[model samples]
Target: MVLPNLNWRAFIRSQPINIMSRSFAAIFAGYLVAATGSGLLALIIPLPASQSVLIAMMLSFSFYVAAAIWAFSVGTSRQAWRDLLLISAILYIFILWVS
Candidate 1:
C-alpha cells in the first residue's frame, strides 16, 4: 500500500493572505458595518424612534447577508475591504452630520 504524502507547507503557502483578510472582514467587520449602518439609518429615518428601531432590528440581518455576499463577490480582498470601509465611513459620517 502506498501512502500519499501531504505537503502542509505547500498548502499553507498556496493560500493567499488577501483571501484570509477578506474572509475575516466578511465575517467580522462586515457585520459591524451592517449593524452600525442599520442603526444609523434607523435613527435618521423620518419614522418615530420606536418604529424605526423595530424596523432596523428586523432589517439588519438582511444588510449583513448582503454585505457578506458583496465581500466575496468582489474581484479582490482589498477591494472588498475598501468598499465596505468606504460605505461604513460614509454612513457614519452621514449619521454624524444628521445628528
Candidate 2:
C-alpha cells in the first residue's frame, strides 16, 4: 500500500511534539552541561591531577540531574531550550577560558 502524506504543520504544532522537544533538551542538553562542567572542574580543582579528574567526574552526576530538573521545571519547551542552551554556552566558554 502507498503511504499517506505527512502534515508538517500539524506535526509541528502538536502537544506531543512539544513534549518531545523538551525531553530532548532535558536529556541531551543536560548531558552537554554535565560533560562541560566535569571538564571545567577537572581543570580548576586544586588537587593532584588524578584526584581532580576523579572528583570532577563524580561531581558531574549532580550537574546532569540538576540540568534535567531545570529543563522540565520551566514554563514552556521554548523557554527550556533557551535556558539550557544559554547555560551550555556559558559553561563551554568558561571551559575555554580555564584552558
Candidate 2 error regions (>4 Å): 1-11
Question: What's the lDDT for candidate 1?
Answer: 0.81
lDDT of model 2 at position 48: 100
TM-score of each: 0.77, 0.84
- Using lDDT as the measure, the top candidate is 2
Candidate 1: where are CA atoms >4 Å away? Answer: 1-13, 16-18
lDDT of 2 at 87: 85
| Candidate 2 to native Cα RMSD, angstroms | 2.4
Q: Name the TM-score of candidate 2.
A: 0.84
* lDDT string, candidate 2, 45-95, tens digits: 999999999999999999999989988888888898888888888988999
